[model samples]
Target: MSLPIVIIGSGFAAYQLVKTLRRQDTQQAITVITASCGDDYAKPDLSHVFTKGQSANDLIKMSADEFAKTYDITLLRRSRVESIDARQKTLRCNGESIAYQQLILATGAKALVPPFQGDAMGRIITLNGLEDYAASEVELKKAQSVLVIGAGLIGTEIAMDLASADKRVILTDRAEALLPSLLPDFVSAQLYQSLGNQGVSIELGTQVESLRQAEESIAISLENGHDYRVDAVVCAVGLRPNIRLAAEAGLKTNRGIVVDRQLRTSDPHIFALGDCAEIDGNVLAFLQPILMSANALAKTLLGQASNVALPPMMVKVKTPRLPMQLSGNTANADANWQVSASREGMTAKAFDEEQQLIGFVVTGSHMKQGFSLLRELPPTF
Candidate 1:
């Protein structure tokens, strides 16, 4: 029998590759090594579960057993891939050596644990996967008020979801505004105000200096000399790619596991994708790019040479209070943004010196207009 194509990690990247590969060639022997229960769930839904009326279990599209049975894959749940032996084409997992024809690293990113002086640091939680969410669900349900650190995309979205679920949410960041790196001031102001309208308190321009246990609640001290006591704390700072295994294997790595356009790593037999993989110097962690990479890699694995080619995909900010979608550099844009606002929504377009649309942002009811704007925007990947 031929050696199976073994994939490390069972996140969206790995599962998507299996799905894409099976769509064309179902008979290929595939094996998945996952750290968790191997339940297939959308990571993006982690923040929106409250607002979307979903529990952690509800987020799972399929269980590991079901998925493996459906796709004819050898699913190893609750398993970890400790080391990769590129030269020998083997993996040291659970004190066992497993061989593979081709290996793919889909080990996703992990939540960034913010550095702070805190005795109660253990009380703060960071959600990055189904397991994290499942573990935090009980604490979230018991808490009335929550302190959410960071005001970036994930932070802001989780804050809104918490607020919408009737939890008193304090959204804070070291930056002056929410998503300061992703939106213009005017647009951010709109979102800031909208979040306020949704009953979320915004504390910007400062980070948590310390966190202390206050009886049953958590005491949070901000660098701005402000303090608050909340029933729970969630740190939604950001994510750092998982590159330790790949790096230990002697594969090239920078911000993430460096791979070529073909999703091939330094070792020709090893490939990578999703949050852990950086292609062409870009670490694309978004769903669209991950799916594209999976499709391209699927073709490549099937002996069809293909490169990851991404379209201008706009990301929808899941804040129901003031919906928004954007692509390209809205913040620090090379050109000035042509701004327009109204009762329906606001739309900002940025044009280069050549007078071509390079980037854009839309909010409120102007989401439908994003189609045309996205078409005009320059290639991002």
Candidate 2:
């Protein structure tokens, strides 16, 4: 009997790897352990639930039993992994010792909740998974107004969704413009104007100072000397990779669990991918890189010795009013942005010192050019 290959998550990375591996080789014992109910859902849909009219239940693409039967693999749902004994090649999950030939960590990421003063901290919510989305749905039903902290991708999307649903939305961020890390000033300015036109109160260059419970609402104080009362607060600041388990298991970790080109961790028998993995010092929390890593890791696990090579990937910001797409130079460093604005929309191109196109942003009618612009940018890795 062969020992099973164990996967420690059931997200996109874990399932994608399993799907990729099973396509090449059948009859390889595979076991998946997940802390959740093991439902297959598109995580990107979580932010657009309001605008799409999707409930939390609608987000689930596949149930645990369905996934298990479809893939012919063992699914352990709602089981928390206690610890991993690397030397013994065993995992202690829910007090059960399970041995494995290989281990893959796809634990994903967690929402970063910054500490703030106030007794109504419980009213602050962060959406990182299905459970968070479900909770947000419940909260939204009871609230007429929402205060969103952070004007990044998730925050802006949620604000748009809520505003579209006739809810009052106030989107606040410490940065001067929206998507400051991903878009050029001109592109972000377009989105800022678009959101404001949609009745979203934009509060840039400000941070939440505190939250206090008011009569049937939460009162939020900002560092910019502004105070507002809202039914709920959603924190979309960012995500921190879930690396505690890997670090506890004695695996090397930085922003995420350290991995190589093949997605192998410090321990050869252990591997990692998705939001939990930092490959060659790059933590790609996007779907494209995760899929790329999954393919390479699947081949490597099957003795193919594959290495992941990713091209420049485009990030589509799902703001219906603005409809922007950005590719490359998300850091906005060491590049000059040359922007052209018109009634149709705005196109901003980022060029390096060599006068080569390194990144680009397309908004509104010009968003159709996003693919062509992506081709001009250099490969990410």
lDDT of 1 by residue, 155-265 (tens): 999999999999999999989988987888888898899889988889998889999988999898888888899998999888899999999999999999999999999
| Model 1 alpha-carbon drift over 4 Å, by segment | none
The TM-score of candidate 2 is 0.97
Best by TM-score: 1
- Give one digit per residue, the lDDT tens place, for model 2 in 1-381: 999999999999999988998998888999999998888889999778877778889999998899999899999999999999999999999898999999999999989889999999888888788888787788776789999999999999989988988889999999998988887676677788888888999999989999999978999999989899999899999999999889999999999999989889999999998999998888899998899889988888888899999999989899888887888885566788788878888888988888999888887898888899888888888
List TM-scores for all candidates, in order. Answer: 0.98, 0.97
Scored by CA lDDT, what does every candidate get?
0.89, 0.89
